[model samples]
Target: MTLRRRATGLALAIATGTTLALTGCDAAKDAASDVIASATAAVASAAQEKMNEIKDGVDAAADVKAGRTSVDGDRTVAEITATNPKDKTADYTVMVNFRDGDGNLLDAVVLNIDGVEPGTSKSGTARSNRTLTGDTTAEIAQALRH
Candidate 1:
């Protein structure tokens, strides 16, 4: 083969190899993105199911309140207070919700405070189910006394 023709062939081979390599990289990136999206959707679905399982008690939400939320080691936490107004001791189940500054729900947790004396207030801490970022606030979503 002529030397000039050999050089042209080698250049063409390198260009083809480079193009194949770039296409492979793009395909790998797309596959990774799809896996990540699937995992995120699964997590969100599980969290929603957990939130839906909670049922509110009659006229008991007014007895529970959530305090300020703060970050603790990548998790959001808040103080929960439950006031027992019944003549007898009561057990309380409280659902606390964590939200961002834009009012988007980040996490929700159920806390149980048992054997609270009548006319007394009991306090507990509610922690997020997963790591949360940015500004977070907490609110009492539901409360039940039994």
Candidate 2:
């Protein structure tokens, strides 16, 4: 072939190769961007789920603290009779007994009273301030009423 024709053909081939290389580089960049976008979306979804779980846990704890259980029970009132006095404080033991309708002993609860005076007949009333899991509190209240 003539030298000028051969040189022209070579230049055309080189230009085509450069164009293909540039297109391949653009495709790679686009693929990488797509992958990054998908990864970012997945991470955001996981974070939202974790936040929802944390909110649910906080709500459950608040319900328990408010004493909003479904347990059936009644309040029992008891009197504090004696106590042991200490420096600016005292402790007293109060007994609470529970029984069924047929007079069968079910349970007993002993609670310590703090800041009570020794040798004093302190006539204070006690009651279950929160809901219980069983009828023990109800039975104790019935026995005290009698």
Best by lDDT: 1
Question: In model 1, which runs have C-alpha deviations exceeding 4 angstroms?
Answer: 1-57
TM-score of each: 0.63, 0.27
Candidate 2 lDDT over 51-137, as tens digits, reads: 333321211111111112123245434443433332333433333343335554333333334444544433334343222224332
Winner by TM-score: 1
- Pairs that collide in candidate 2 are none
Error of 2 at 100 (Å): 3.8
The ten-residue window of minimal lDDT in model 2 covers 58-67
